[model samples]
Target: MAMRKAKVQEQVVQAVARSNPGDRLVATVHGISGPAPQLTMAFGFIMLFVVKYYFVTVTERAVVVHRAAKFTGRPGDVVFNLPREQAHGIASEVRHGRQWNSFRLLFPGAAKPTRINVAAPWANDLGRLLSALGAAAPASG
Candidate 1:
């Protein structure tokens, strides 16, 4: 099982790399939307449903957010691209009230930060990757 998981991860990394030429992947976190019961009970069901929509790629120069239709049965979209220099930080929090674990990309110029409820299992890996990216982010002049 572990080997299979690793193989799948490799494939995912390769696919992302192919689509994002010139960018080197630093890390990836497979987001999970929680169990059926939790998803059904959550207010953000729609968003959570697509939590596993795509893998989040942290590259040397940018944070690429891609949405794949394979998970949603709808045409995918490139949600957004945040340059490392512009990202102020990455924040992860547990909303006890909602029983949600969320991750946000902070941008100084933006009024609101971009946020997502990170699937439970991938939380730690994602947090670490984002933290590394934050630390490595180019200083803004």
Candidate 2:
């Protein structure tokens, strides 16, 4: 399982690298693509219904979210390429003694923010992932 994850992660990095040759890959967190609040009751059900999860990756230049295919977990398409400046408003919370990170990814020119729910084990990586996103974000001058 670890080997497969690493392989898919490499593929994702390679895909992002093609469009952003100079931008280096930083962190990636796989998340359920929906509102955390709404999915509270049917979280497990929703996850089971989901055919693809968002492979949210942070690079030196941007925060990119891709629809990762099942089984292989390879990235399918570039769903979002959020400018570092727009990388804001995500928060970490503890619910029922479990760590959960919820955020709405607002892509430029888009009508709405894409909700991403990250649960523990995966949410365990949020500290560094969030740091990478913030580290590359443009200063609000």
Candidate 3:
């Protein structure tokens, strides 16, 4: 099972790499006309597709959480499949939680939550995707 998961992850990373050969080679859009408009348009188009297609999956001993944040992945979307593990004390603020606005108590840890956005535009789509996956498993624990 782990090998299959790793293979799937590797394929995704390879696909992303192939799609974007140069990470920082974006063309400028403010100065020219015609083709320049296309450049700016391309940025939005590519980013949208990346957000829609990319997914992040994290698996622990008991449960697995999958997030599709793209470049803006949040930990909340991470579904907690197992509850035996304490909800706090981990490095993940979204998973463990943390303080917010110096008022809201999240996880009760001092360290700020690390943000690992997968880059999705909307959280709803991600939720629906997870729901479908969950239905298939129907979590035993």
Candidate 4:
């Protein structure tokens, strides 16, 4: 009986995974390198750095939730949902962000997964982007 129950649970999880694949989560870092000609060259390096460290795509049975934090300058949490089998691998990367950390989990009782931390300079723009994404996610979800 226990084995039978386990098989059923496994099947259910597989069904969920087949329906919702993982998504990619990317956190772009932006800051001034210097000024002009010199800054332009430096900016290239900065972009490369950001691309290498922060280009994450949550693939295979996952959902991304962008959370907005009440802080300044730090990026908000971009949470990803993973199949139960893949959940363990996600924890480490989720906690190792330069500006923000993330975690993988099942749906919380009421909260969403992805979040963005807005800075004073970017508050207005970030707020709008988040709102738009939030509004759009429901239909996609």
Which candidate number would show the highest lDDT if scored against the true structure?
2
Residue 33 C-alpha lDDT in model 2: 64
The runs of at least 3 residues in candidate 1 whose Cα sits more than 4 Å from the true structure, single-residue gaps closed, are 1-8, 32-54, 70-76, 90-100, 106-111, 135-141
TM-score-superior candidate, 1 or 2: 2
> What local distance difference test score does each model get?
0.52, 0.63, 0.27, 0.29
Query: Could you tell me which 10 consecutive residues in candidate 4 have the lowest summed lDDT?
Result: 132-141
Model 1, range 11-106, lDDT digits (tens) per residue? Answer: 656666666777887766543333432654475646445444445667787676666443332213555567766644544432322234445554
Which order, best to worst by TM-score? 2, 1, 3, 4
Q: Model 2 clash tally?
A: 0
Weakest 10 consecutive residues of candidate 3 by summed lDDT: 25-34
How many times do residue backbones clash in model 1? 0
Against the true structure, candidate 4 has what lDDT?
0.29
Q: Against the true structure, what is every candidate's RMSD? A: 7.5, 6.2, 16.6, 17.4
lDDT of 2 by residue, 43-73 (tens): 7555655534777888887788788765556
* Higher-lDDT candidate of 1 and 4: 1
Query: In candidate 3, residue 87 scores what lDDT?
Result: 28
Candidate 1 has a TM-score of: 0.56
TM-scores for every predicted model = 0.56, 0.66, 0.20, 0.19
